[model samples]
Target: MLSEVTATRYVTPLREGGSLPGIVEADDLGTYVMKFTGAGQGRKTLVAEVICGELGRRLGLRVPELVTMQLDPVIGLSEPDQEVQELLKASGGLNLGMDYLPGSLGFDAKAYQVSSAEAGRVVWFDALINNVDRSWRNPNLLVWGGELWLIDHGATMIWHHNWPTAQVSAAKAYNASDHALAPFGPDIASAAAALAPLVTEELLTEVAAEVPDEWLVDEPGYATTDELRRAYVEPLLARAATIHERITLDAPAEDKPSQAPGWLSERLAPRPRATKNDKDGGQ
Candidate 1:
């Protein structure tokens, strides 16, 4: 289970996203980015965030640590933003909090060249979860401490929105043509070989079981939260088995020709070590 904490104050909303996630100060004296249950996407979005974000963490990818935050509706009284006030009041109890990474710059492929291994690993992870939001325009990736971090997994597992028709085949073909690092030609085969074996039934079961019971309640066709947890795991385990083949079969041609690669090779070719100032890329 994730660490549980009490949210002591509601700071300000991060308006960059549709769900209106906000920066919150908690009793633990740590700042967190809280994803509200009352947002338009609803509790279901938070469900995906926990499952996929934690799964990625266990798979050795960089993701912000997640915690179960206890929110009090009374805090709404002090908020001037009516929209935020209503969201807080509605999401009175348990919500999801991702540890806030301060001074992190949004990932820009042009600004920083990602190695093939890193790109491949990320692409592989995204494909397994059926995430469709890593396009070049809105990468949903952050760079902190000169390392990449994945975030905003609420958009993954869209099939869960309609439980009746959802199938293991939810792991459909992924079109990576517009992905932020598509030009790098990720080593999907190598990544799949290393990561696929790690996605065992036990791992998915543990990850799915971590969702707060409050968020899992009232889910249609399930009488208990345990059943809902199983529903989340089954499709994901099925996808893990076939992700590599699906992506390799569906991947389109790259922008640059096969012979000459662009920015990545030039940036990676042996040269003087990058200075700390250079790492910021002038954010």
Candidate 2:
């Protein structure tokens, strides 16, 4: 369990985040981004942050540390001054703090032009988990300490609910022509081979264990932590090698700018786009 801290100081909101994460100094002298889970999307986002973020770390990817936080209600729903209160109300629960990446830039594939092998590994991992967040426009990658760190996995495994029938197939089929597509080949194959063994039932169970019970309760499709783990986490780990092989062989090698889809990119981007009516000269 994460420790509780009194909210004495307020950290500024991050311009890019949807949940409006704030920077705060914990009682333990650690700095973190306090993220409030607002209405509608609060619990799910937290679960994704914890489960996927932890799993990625286990798989040897760099992800920021996360901790549970409590926002002071007295602040009560204001921006800049009452920002913490507003965050608490919007999130529907207490606030969460993400470990801030000091002086780190968001992920830019162009910055990393690594070997096809490394790209292949990243692609395979993304594909295996059906990660739709890492796209051309808003690649949720960060550069810190001269390495690429993956972030914001709240959108992965959506296909599970969105496309229930879809399953890992022997046929490797994914759109690899995107500019951000990882270079695929034997290097990816070798990397997959090395990483395949790391994905196991125990690993999945451990990852699932980290998910809060609030996320697992009263859901018809996914009831109980173990069931959710079996349904979602287990399949990906089981098919890790196959999925990796498929993504490596099937994806195209191209260099493209990071741009997410229309709605998604709008949410993830540092700046919002003008509405169509605004563009059309509406008052």
Candidate 3:
């Protein structure tokens, strides 16, 4: 399991995220962003966060360090917001904590550009996880210390919500046309070449072990938490075997800046080179 720490204080909620995660100070003298197990999305959200976030870190993508935070209900007593207090009370046990990076900025595709290699790896990973939240409208990427970091993985692994058909769901083609990185020219083949071989059974087992046992208990079909952990591993490994081949960026040619719909063409238009005659005339 990831390092476990106890929350000492809840500072404020991050209004931007759908789950209303908050900034917290932990007893270890570190600050973290807390994802509550009691969010409307349920413990399944945190489960995805741990599984996907840890997997990305292992795959050499930048993801914040994670921990299993011990949240005490009493920490909410000082908060005036009734909703926040209720949520804290309900999430009194284990929750998810991401190491807080101070002064980080949200990703802006317009202002910044990532290399095709980086874009491909991220898009490929998102496809395998079935994350639909990385669209241009709400890119869940962060720029901290000049490198991109992935966060907000709660929306991935939708099949877990319907356990009976998870296998079938895992085989479907991913829709990444609107992915924020789509316009950046993702090199999916290279991503598969580099990361696919690393997703071994041993790696999956280690990743699954990081999920807290409490979240795995009483899952509808599983008799024990270990059984549930194995369930998480099977679908992902199966998806990884075939998903890379099916991930066609699918973004139209016009989406690329050089061929964009209207003004983009003008912005990318090539300027004529100055001739020798023109240079001599100026001289």
Task: Please report the candidate that would top lDDT against the real structure.
Answer: 3
TM-score computed on alpha carbons, candidate 1: 0.87
Per-candidate alpha-carbon RMSD to the true structure: 7.3, 10.1, 4.7
Q: Model 2 has how many clashing residue pairs? A: 17
By TM-score, who's the top model here? Answer: 3
Candidate 1: give its CA RMSD in angstroms. 7.3
Per-residue CA lDDT of candidate 3, range 44-154, in tens? 999999999999999999999999999989999989999899999999899999999999999987667788899889999999889989887788999999899999999
Q: Write the residue-wise lDDT of candidate 2 on 1-283 in tens digits.
A: 4345655456566657665666777666778877666634556666667767777788887778767766665445444455555555555445566777888887654445445566666666667666766666567777788877777777666544532553533123444434253322225567677777888878877877766665566656664667765666656665675675445233232243332213223334587679988899995
Q: What is the TM-score of each candidate against the true structure?
A: 0.87, 0.73, 0.90
Worst 10 residues of 1 by lDDT: 256-265
Number of the candidate with higher lDDT, 1 or 3: 3
- Indicate the residue-level lDDT of 102 in model 2: 88
After superposing candidate 3 on the true structure, give the runs of residues whose Cα lies further than 4 Å from its correct spot.
Answer: 251-283
Model 2 worst lDDT run, 10 consecutive residues = 258-267
| Candidate 2 local lDDT, residue 93 | 42
